[model samples]
Each structure stands twice: as structure tokens, then as C-alpha cells.
Target: MSRVLALLVALAAPWTPLLRAAAARPEHAPCAALALSPAPAPTGRPALQDAPICKKCQSTGRLPCAAHPRSDCLLEDEVLFCSVVADCTACAGAAWVPCTDCDNAPARARIEEKKASVATRRVALEYIDQTMKRPIRKAESKHFVLVWEMDRLKVDKKWLESHELLHLYLKRLEALYDDYCARMQITDKEFAEKFRVFVWQFPQDHHDAGLRFCRQSAKGGVKLMGQTPSYSVCGNKQNFQDDERLHRNIVHSVTHLILSAQRPVAWIGNIKAGWLDEGLAHFFEDRYWDVCDTYCYQEANTNVDFKGGRFRLAVRRMVEEGKFPPTAEVFQQNVDTLTLPMHATAFSYVEFLLNRDAERFNQLVKKLKAKVATRDALREIYGWSVFDFEAQWKSWVLSTYPTK
Candidate 1:
């Protein structure tokens, strides 16, 4: 019985204080009344010292505190206190949140799009490699690419991929040639020999290489590729969709390319005189008008303006009258003074020369090649001085194509 009584008493002792406190405190007792001391005195200065120390700093004993530092605590009655202390994990004003899974569906889509673009670029590169039989190096700097676009190349939807690829291939080929020349100290003749040999090894390779060289050297590095290789058609597809225009455009462009290759100095880097340059291209290709009609030229009148047409006719009349300029002057005339009228005059002159004396015309071209700028070459070939040739040519043109 004594042992049982002692066990019960030990158990009761543990709970006695809680029961006594509950009974002693009334439910309605005021918290302010229960507080032991009166409110603290106010200090005029900012309650900096009264602020609570950071819990992290207090536990870790590090200065400047971590979470809920002394600098961050707010004071009410000259006593500092923190809204939250134990759970705080960062310095004052810091933001913290639980880790979240980044939703990257949009980002993934963009990455995939970029990959597709890269793949397209690679396809273009491969096409150039197979076509030109040359390894191409891409210009890594964006600046070079931009300059290439402005000064050397342009691309559109019709031939964006194809044209840019060609430009890159050409750049690579030039670089390779320069490198070879530097290493082997080869003369122009030797370089040409090696180049021709490489190109001739395969028949298709030869054709492609020839065309590429012609296209690059001609047109002053302007490359335009379309489904039909017809500029008129390309323009139509881009604007009016007129098929006849397409055919004319093709003839003109192809002629330009061929003549430019044959007479490189006349076209390349001769931007100031594009009129004569263009006239020569037109004159040479005019022979292929029948082919042009077959594609798309009959529906549209592909004639130059009246003034230009008159000029062309006058030039033709001059050739008819045997009063043409020296071959050198003909090639080297400044385009600005040789306006549309002058172009027409020149074209007509060239046409008459070709039609009436094809052999003489051919000989003149050969002579021009030997002495591109010699007055003596002109006098020997045509029996006329430069000034006399000009005056007589003008007189003949005035008689033939009178200004209206």
C-alpha cells in the first residue's frame, strides 16, 4: 500500500504546478497588467542600439549578423524586436524562395529553330562544295559578313541560300589561290595552268568552274540566281509576275555575264560608266532575241526610253557611215557624258560594224586587246583620229536619229 501511494504521489507532483497556475490566472486577466515592468523610456535618437541582434549572427557569433541583424530590427518602446527571427535565413531586404523547376518550353523551341537554320546553312555549304569542287571557309566575324552583303553580295528569297553559298565559295577559292601563289611563288601563267588542269580533270567540273569564273569576274560580283536564271522572270516573280519580262531579263543578264567575262576591264570596277557596260551586254545578246521570245518576251515591249533608243540608233548610223570612234575610246568613254542618247548611238554603231564587216569587227577586238588605249592602234585599224572619229560619228547620228 505504501509503495502504491508513493507512485501515485510522484505522478501527481509533476502536474500540480500546471493546475495551480491555471486556477490562479483568470481567463479575462489583462496582458498589460500581467507584465512585470512599466513601458521603457523613449530615446530621441534612432533606436539603433535597442534593435535585436540577428539570430544567425548570435548563434554563429559573426559580426554584422546574417538574418534579422541589429541593423534591421524595428523599435517600438526603445526596445528592438524582429517580426520573424528563428526562421529567417538571409540578410535584411534579401528575397528568398523555395527552388522551382524552370519552365523552358519556349526556350527549347527557339533552340530547335536555331538548329534548323544551321542545318539549312550547312546544306548550302555542301551544294557549293559539290558544285565548285572547292573547300570554303566561312567568314567568322559578323562585320565581314555584313560588309560582304553591302559591297560584294546580296541575297533574297529567290536565291538567298544559293547566292550566299556561291559568294562564300568564291571567297574561299580566292583565298586558296592566294595561299598557293604565296607558297609556291608561281607566276600568273603557272597558276592558270594548274587551275585549268584541276578544272579539266572532270568534264562537269570544267563547265561549272568556267561558269563560276565568268560569273564572278563579270557583273562586278553581283550574283542573282532564280528558278529560271532569267532576270525578267525573277523581277516578275518579285513584282508583276509577267513571264515575258522574265525572258527578256534572262537574255540581258546572261549576255552581260558572257560579255563581262570576255571584256573584263570594260565592266568590272567600272561603276561610273554602267551605261556603255550595259549597252555592250545588250548588243551582244540581242542576237538571241529568238530564244528570248520563246521564254517570255513577245507580250512586253522591252525597249529603252525614246532618248536612249535614238542614241543607240545614231551610234548604229555612225558605224554605217564608217565614222566610228577608236576601239579604245569606244571602250573607255566615260558613261556620265555618254547618256542614254550616247548609249543608243554606240550600240547602233557596234551593231552596224558587226553586220557590215564582221571580219573587221573581229580584227578590231583583237587590236583593242593588244593596245587597249593606243591612238595609233585606232588610226591603223579604222583610218581615223580620235577627234575626227567623234565628229564624223556625231554627224552621221544627227542625220539618222534626229532629236524630236
Candidate 2:
């Protein structure tokens, strides 16, 4: 290689490992690879030690002299052209000394994990692009990559060819992701590396495919639905019947995916309260989407209409009938036992907490993500007992939610 290219490569080469290490442990600073200081000798240069040393110069605050590595600059290279200068890059060049154990077992494990993550991400992206018959750039800082099967969609092939619907879906998701992150107070780096999604065109296809892929069955008949089966994977059944329903299903399923990604515990134990999980997703599903404007920003409950007002009305009826399950009971229900009315109530409860104090809701989610128990997290973050919370939430629902 040319001298200039070699020098540039030497300077840049040290950063690759550091960047990877930093991504794995964002909480700490990247450790610099050092040059091993040699052992002392009476009348000759010291032998190089095994340990690495820092490269900074103490006095000049620049790169240390290579002739006397890590030194302030006492050694001069007399054989080079700029022989007089103690530390001249052109005359007295520096080279990176490979640190021992740099690619140890632990580092190799991390590399493998990163490679697996990238491969999964790439597959999801490719499937979506190819199936949609349109190219899309990979989304940056996104947890879930969407997969759609076009064969199951009910739309005419001519319509698909004419419109840029795929682009719109991706754009909406990107915007929604940003909004979700902002509301949840999630930093970009806190995002999980693995999140996969499949959106099938037909309801039956989505249901069967989800069960087959996840290697499990949903109890009480396989109803058409969208869900996050594992912490990292989510799937949805697209509705050719109603565009609104399709949007809602996508939003609901993706919400679960995002929440699942947030937890730091093992996948099996990472399940949040059923109410919060479903509520958060339902909350986003009902969020207003307008095609007229691109830059419009809507905060929670701002001119928001539950267009598919069934859930809202169902929740109101439950309150009037005095048959609503206690918040404690609802919290105990996993994805399996979550009834229809329970889903509505969950949505209302989430909306109540969010509209009342978004920051407190965020704190509640933060606590849950930290692996705190559902009951304890709610009590600590909201400062209310279960009974007290239920009472407050019921009153808020009865007053604010419309009966009609």
C-alpha cells in the first residue's frame, strides 16, 4: 500500500473493535488498546512486554514517539529525513501493535451474536421488499422488520401495481416508531437487536402461519388475530375487509412487539401485565392517522376519535353494568385469558393513565421493564394501592368515556 494510505489505515484500524465493544456496553467508555512497555536494560533497548500501553503523549498531548513508545518525546530518528524533530509523523512513523487476547472467546461470542442479529434483520428486510414488489431501505434504529405475503391480500393486482402503498406503510411505521420511543422515554441505543414480523394477506393464512412458525397453538380455537408470540417475533392478519381494521391490527401487534423488546429479563419471564401490553397496543391502534398532511403531530387524546368505537362503548357498558374486572384481576390475566371486554377496559385504563400523566405512565413502564412485579411497579410508580387505583380508574372512565 502507498505510505499515505497505510498511515490512514493504521490510525483508523484501532477504532473498529472499540466501536463494537461500545455497542455492546453503552454504559461504559471503550477501553483503548495499549502497547506493552518493554522491560528495562542497562545498555540496550528494552524487550517488549506482553501487556499493552496507552498511546497518548504526556507533554505534547499528541501521539507519543514511536521510537520510545508512550514516551513524551526524548527519542529522535536520526536515519529519517526530519531527523532533528523528536516526534515527526512523516520522519518517525507509528504502527499499531496488536494486543494479545484481543480476539478472545468472549469477543468471538459477541461477534457471533451480532452476526446472527444482522442476518435476521436482513432476511426480514428482503422478504418485505420482494413480497411487496417494491424496494425499501432498511429502517435505522427500528426494532421490528415487517414481512408481508402478497398472495394472501384481497386487493387487485392492478391496484397494487398503480399505488405506492408499500412506501406509505413503511413511512407510517417509521413515524410511529419515533413517537413510541419518545412517549416511552426509550433511547435509541436501548432498542433490542432482534424483532421480526410477518403480515399475511388473509386472516386464516396469518393465523395458521403464526401457529406453525411459533410451534404453538392458541387455546379456544385459532381466531384470526395479530400478536407477539415471542419477545422478538410478532405477526398480524391483514384485513381486506376494512382498511381501518388492518391498520388497527398492525398497530396493536407492533405495540406488543415493541413492549416485549423493552424488557431486560429472559424471554419466558419478560411478559408484562396483560392490561398494559394490550392497552398500549390498542391505544396506538386508535391513534388518528390522516393522509392529507405529513408533518402533523398529535399528542395523546388530541382530537382523537375512536372511529372503531366498539371497544370504547363496550368499556363504558361494562362500567355502567358494574361488571368490570378489578385492575388487579386484569393484571393477572396473561394473553390467554384476556376477554373482549377486558381488552376494551385495558385500552381505557391505559388511555386514562396516559391522558392524566404521561410521565407517570412512562415511569410505570420503566419500572416494569426493569423486571419489577406488575403490582409493585404500578404501586411504586403511581403511588396507589390496587383498590385505590381501581376506584380512580373506574371514576375516570365513567366520567370521560362517552356512553353512546
Candidate 3:
């Protein structure tokens, strides 16, 4: 072999096994081969004794946060990154305070280091704190910073305090984030920033947060849609009456924000892509809540029974009775212009596309976000014109949805 060719082959040989190992392991491992190294055989010797640990901290030199009930502090790893814990004067989001009873220098130093890391950035998350003159219950998860101010909520048939509610909502936000990523086939690298969401107890608080974060004032609830989307909601006694209602509202709003922030990073709601925008939002709302009651951007959803919120039967009947609007017309309108019936049909259209195949649905969205016209994107991905989509969606809704 030529000298340079031989050198190239030798250099490439080591990488092939490493690459294959990474492919073999679970997704997103930084170095698969190194991580997969076999364990060494144990030597015939006793393990070293651990250093003296505080009984409370167990040698970690950090104590559990006592600001909350013991049950709230005993969180799983997934729930550990919550902002309520971060906002706590005791733990400061670290989930661990220094062990006061014992003098463990290592634990104290580690706790101090974590506190230092979080301390520098507290101001960015302090808008609500500044307004309230008291800390609001807040939490963080994989893709969102959630500020929740509801005093108490009943979750899973049990009443929970403010901090407990924050942890539960943070967990749900992470789950929603995962579902969105899965449906869109998204990667971490595709996103530029995490979402900022606010769920307030009053309209005034909602309006304040909207002005600060969204730069627009709204009464019921409002969102700043696009890349880095924000949701600010006023959980009044009228619209958001209970836990279930509030959860559904947040889901609907976050769905819009996440879609707008993904990849191409633009809100299509105002650009006559309202069908896809509103449809997908409603689709996720129903997917989670089993019925859709939440509405935004004026679909006449205020106090309207609208099939008692069982949209499937309502949509199926729309097709059976031949009352649904024209596909091309509905697709042409902005989000604010859709009639209530049109919004129902829009959800069905998105559902039909998604139920047909999630990957294809993802491709359609990516195409639309890339500035491709909805007509062309539908044609390229599903081989259908808007008219064809209408016919197919109507057929599928009638066949699949329940008559009752």
C-alpha cells in the first residue's frame, strides 16, 4: 500500500468501532465506546470507609429543604429541577441546603458552589417577584420556565400546597415538551431557547406578566407566539375555575408556543396558515384532556356548548350533515377569523393527517415552517390538494369518530 493510503486506513480503523458502539447504545450519549467499557474484576480487599457524614445530610453535607412539607422535598430526579425549589429561600433551587448540625467542609463547599451558580441568574426570573414583593411559586423543567401563583390545587384527588402544585405542573410541562419533540422529530440543537410560561391567579397578574414578557395586554389569557414563545394566563373564577380547566388552557397555549418556536421559529397564526396553527393546538388539547374547551384568538368559544366539548361527535356530524366549510376557504383565513365550526373541522384536518402517519405530519410542519405554502406542502408530503384533504378528512372523521 502507498504510505499515505496506509496511514489513512490506520487512522480510520479505530473510529469505525467507536462509531458503531455509539449507534448501538441509547440515544444522545456523548461518548458511547468509553461509556461502554467493561467493569474491572474486584480485588480481594475491603472497600474504604466513607468520611464522617452528618446524620441529616448523610455525608453529602447538604440538608433537605424544610420550607416545604417532607413529601414535597422527597422528589424523584425528574422533579428535582423545579423552580419552586430554586425560588425557595432555603435551597435556592439547589434542592439541598447546607448541613448546619455538622461541619462537613466538602458538603458545605459543594452546596455553596451550587448556590453561587444559581444566584447570578435569579434576576432574570424575578419579574413576578419584583411585582408581588414576595416570591411566586415557580419551577423549571427540560424546556420551560413556569411561574405558577395559584395558592392551592387538587391533584390526583388530593389537595396540594403552592410548592407541590409547582412541581406537578413542571413535571407535566416536561412531558408535554417530550410529546412535542417526538411528534415533530425535533432535536435539542433545533431550539434556541426555553419557553417562559405564567399561570396567574388574577387578570391583573396575567396582564402584568403579558406586558413584561409578551409586550401586549390581554384579559383572559395571552401568548407571545414565535420563537421563544411565552404564555401568560389569568386564572380567574370565570374561565379557569378548577385544576382541570386551568391545565387544559395551559396545554393549549403552550402547544401554540412550542410549534411556533420549533425550527423555522415563526408564528403562522396571522399569515393565513391558521388551520395548521389552530388545528394542531386544538388537537393536542383534546389529546390530553379528552375534550376541548379552551379557545384563543376569537373562535366564538366563549360560553358556547359546542357539542358539550365532545368535538369528535360534533365534527363527525359536521361531515354527515354536510355543514362543514370549504377546505380552501378555511385554509385561507387567519386564526382570528375561523368560525367555531371551522375550528372544529380544523382540528379534524390536523388529526387526520397526524393519525395517517406522525412522520409525514412532521414533514408537513417542517415544510410549512420553511416558508413553503401550505398548498404546496400538502401536495409534496401527502400528494393532496386542499380539496382532496377536505374529502379525506371528512371520510376519516365519519368512520372513526363516535356517533354519540
- In terms of lDDT, the best-performing candidate is 3
Q: List the residue pairs that clash in candidate 3.
A: 83-139, 83-140, 84-138, 86-93
- Once fitted onto the true fold, the runs of candidate 1 whose alpha carbons sit more than 4 angstroms away are 1-126, 129-234, 239-241, 263-276, 284-331, 334-338, 367-371, 374-376, 391-404
lDDT of 3 by residue, 1-404 (tens): 33543444466675554444334433434242333552232343111122343577665556767786557666523442455556677677666677787676766776676666556546666665786567677765567788888778776789888777777787788888888777767777767888888888777777777887887887767888885588888765666667888788888888999888877788878878888898988898889877877778742226654677788889888789998888888877788888888888888888888878888987877787777888889999889987887778877887899998
Ranking by lDDT: 3, 2, 1
Q: Please provide, for model 1 over 44-65, each residue's C-alpha lDDT reduced to its tens digit, 9 standing for 90 to 100.
A: 3212223343454332223322
TM-scores for all candidates: the values are 0.33, 0.51, 0.78
Between candidates 1 and 2, the lDDT winner: 2
In terms of lDDT, which candidate is stronger, 1 or 3? 3
Best candidate according to TM-score: 3
Model 2 lDDT, residue 236, Cα? 32
Per-candidate RMSD vs. true structure?
32.8, 17.9, 10.1
What's the lDDT for residue 343 in model 1? 55
State candidate 3's TM-score. Answer: 0.78
- Clashing residue pairs, backbone N/CA/C < 3 A, model 2: 34-52, 34-53, 35-53
The whole-model lDDT of each prediction reads 0.36, 0.49, 0.73
Q: Worst ten-residue run, lDDT, model 1?
A: 141-150
